[model samples]
Target: MADQDPPKKPSSGLRPIERLNSEERLSRLTPATATATHHEYCSKFARDFLDAHFYYCSSKFVVARGGKVKALDEAFREAESWFSKALDWIAATEKIEIPLFYESREVQVSHSFAGRLLRLLMQYDRIFAETLYSLNCGSITADSRETTTVIAAKRIKSIQQLCIPDTDKFAPDGTLLNSSRSQTHGHA
Candidate 1:
């Protein structure tokens, strides 16, 4: 028999601990473009989290225990907090002014550095939605009265088609008469 070659082991460079520490320190340093980066990260995370959560709650949680439900709820809450903080960070960095209108009085609301950074993240979400629509990516239902009416009409037609007449008891002339033909035809 031929000697089989040893299976190649996947390499994790010798000093992983040192590499990890360096990477951690690099992430901690606030970059000159930190606001843009933070916004992008937060927005992407929020979008992914929302999509996953929707799928899980809609189909995966039907028979979940209380503990599982609680865990998922906590995770969702955390995601929301992250999203809010990202938005705050973006707003703060950009200094985008939001004018508040109350009782016909215009009030200028100033954003902090964090808020500006977070707002940049939101741009990704807007772009995501636009891309999905432009690509005709998923099932998009119309929320219109006309669509509802059409659906209702079809349902009514289906129900009418399903109804069976008692042919055994009623004659074509509308008389309550028992006949062998009526029994066979199911028109009573």
Candidate 2:
């Protein structure tokens, strides 16, 4: 044959042999390895708990401060969405019926996640309940009201600091709150 172009190699590049071997091993994972993987995944899911708690506290602050609850409501909903994702992952791990189980990382992570979630939910529940009781009672003294306002403001500031790395940008001004309250009551 006259000088013809050499037969072209396939366009797809070859995968490294080591990578292929590793993937094969991963696919054929033993129970212990699988559990370890699950544990790692669950551990990562803990961030969702923090995010959800942050938003829930934000919602409470919004309500406490007489701000429009809609925005914070949406934020809380988003937190719930993250919590649902975590729950879904936990549920999947529960379905994995492994007998003769060693104390795998997955089992440890699962217990940790469960405990964290429970405590967070319970704490928020109590906070919300107390807030509602305070609101409905509507008989708090002026000093008590001022103290509550200050605490709510502090909580908002704390949550903002948690969620935003640059706290300065999101910082709340206690002076502004005080000025507004004074003006509203014709104190100054």
Candidate 3:
């Protein structure tokens, strides 16, 4: 009989374990953690409220000074209520800590991360409330627009400081900071 190559064995209907193994390997290699996407989204929403408030403040200042006091007052009042809603949302979100699933990491790191995020969110909320309160009392006079502007600037600065100190905690992927910086810097 002529020599012939041995027939290849058919694959065992079992989908190759390699795929499962690879997935398992990837999961293991990457830290097994649940992300705080909800918290982040809420924070971003709060920030947006602040942005809107600032825009309203500037426009109101200009319009009010231009003697359109009625329209400016209306816009300011609207901004104030919007800020209040944002503050409430942030407070509610901070009350809940969405746990991340990590593979046996030290509790301190996890706690620290949660703590920092909570603190930053709270700080932003407080600042928003304070700004609104000041605006409501007419603390920012039309003549002292510079002073009011300074106050607004300080509140924003404080928020930036809080956010920058622990970027990793609040924004592990740097997406938030990057987007904000790019937008602000581009305008500048």
Candidate 4:
């Protein structure tokens, strides 16, 4: 018979067995061997305290900074490999030219996809809360956040920053706050 092309291998979507298996043989654990895994005997709370705290702090800080909130940084880190495939993803850069509070002055805010999440926090950025602007504390970062982890022992040099006071925080009736001020919160 004339030479014919061999049948093509069926495309079974999987990695080669040898490539997936460990190159080196794994050694069995012996009495002397100490594995990195440890069984800590503590209350379930103490065991997960750090992780819980991290999630809380990360989410709170992210929202306060007007950034998109992720479900969990740990989960994000874990799934990054699997979810990084940009098969259906678009790498297009998008931006919205909206005036935001940078240094008490209205500056055009532009960033890579900042319009998606940053807009939540940026919406409230205004000196006067006459309209939808709820009036918010200025983005004030101190040179020495001594109370925080920034300061080792002594206070470092601080930045001389300023913010335009939110005038809408006051009641239009010209009286002390008698109603709820939950919606209109500012660090003035």
Candidate 5:
């Protein structure tokens, strides 16, 4: 056989490090934008974590330790790790450097930031549970709707396929055929 060209490697759109080091990525964000990005990343982590919880609950497990509550706890901890990474990214990459002149103002700012972080952590459990429940409900509704549509389509097809009796030779009352003999005798 003629030597075939070596199989081409599939191209991934961009290498992670290249994307990170690119000019667009290196461009500085306003503090507000940076804060929003941080929250967005953490929110994605929260959603993925909730999805994992649902998966675990649905999966067939060999061990007794794989109960829903246990699975939920495991998923929560994994998501928290991702959230921690986001926090670290904010600290290391998105610094909002400002010289503090007034001690009281600085104290207030610090307290507010801390409070925000704590509030987010507190909300995680409720948010995760709500997301899982909503997704489950949506899937169930979609499945039921699909089943109903298929059943209705089948019923309609069956009805259409039924053979109706031909009625061209029948009388209006449907008890007897139209008599050619009556017409012939009356005329004769």
Candidate 6:
């Protein structure tokens, strides 16, 4: 029998959600980037994260999660463009030991960097939801944003159960620059 190169396997079987997550994690690893020079790579995380949320929001909910909505699709596309531009204003390795999900994947789940990251993700979800909701007339109907709204709450709740204790005083400083509140407030 001919040896047909033993059916190749995927190098990585990361899910869409996981990919989105990985991008966000990668984005955070950098301390500062002189505004990232404004690029698609910069918006990668925001685009991916919100895209996943959009998929979750679709009432067409299918296969793995849900289908995409036209209005939201455009909205998100434009949103990413705006986000990329925003990156112009402000702004990882695989095997060499970079904390992808769980801070070296060795820490306890409750203490992992992931919980802190998820907290930031939850914050993003909220801002996006609120922004979209307001722009669309205070209407978060079941057909558009129901699942995302519902699922994220549940997901956050589950993750928070492990996070609550440590989360009390452990904030990630998502910008990675570790900007102090005064620095952020100074601009405002």
- Which candidate has the top score in lDDT? 3
Off by over 4 Å in 3: 1-114, 141-188
Question: What TM-score does each of the candidates earn?
Answer: 0.24, 0.22, 0.24, 0.13, 0.20, 0.21
Winner by TM-score = 1
RMSD of each: 26.5, 19.3, 19.8, 26.9, 28.8, 21.8
The model with the greater TM-score, 4 or 5, is 5
By lDDT: ranked, best first: 3, 2, 1, 6, 5, 4
Off by over 4 Å in 5: 1-66, 97-188
Count clashing pairs, candidate 4: 0
lDDT, model 4, position 138? 20
Q: Per-residue lDDT of 1-188 in model 3, one digit per residue for the tens?
A: 46988887787766544432122332343334312222321234345433333222222222222223333234334444544564554343322233322221111112222333333434454544444444445654344433433443444443333333222333332223343566766875
lDDT of 6 by residue, 1-188 (tens): 59667887788886455532233443344324212211121223334543443222211111111111222233334444543442232211011122222111111111123333333443444434443443355334444344444443444333323322222232343112333587777865
**What number of clashing residue pairs does each candidate have, in the order they appear?**
30, 0, 0, 0, 0, 0
Off-target runs (Cα >4 Å) in candidate 2 are 1-68, 94-188
Residue 73, model 6: lDDT of: 32
lDDT of 5 at 169: 35
lDDT of 4 by residue, 1-188 (tens): 46988889888877565411121211111212212211221222222322222122222222221111222222233333222221112112122233433332121112211221122122112111111111122222222121221221111101000001122322443222323565577433
Preferred candidate (TM-score higher): 2 or 4:
2
**TM-score comparison, 3 vs 6, better candidate:** 3
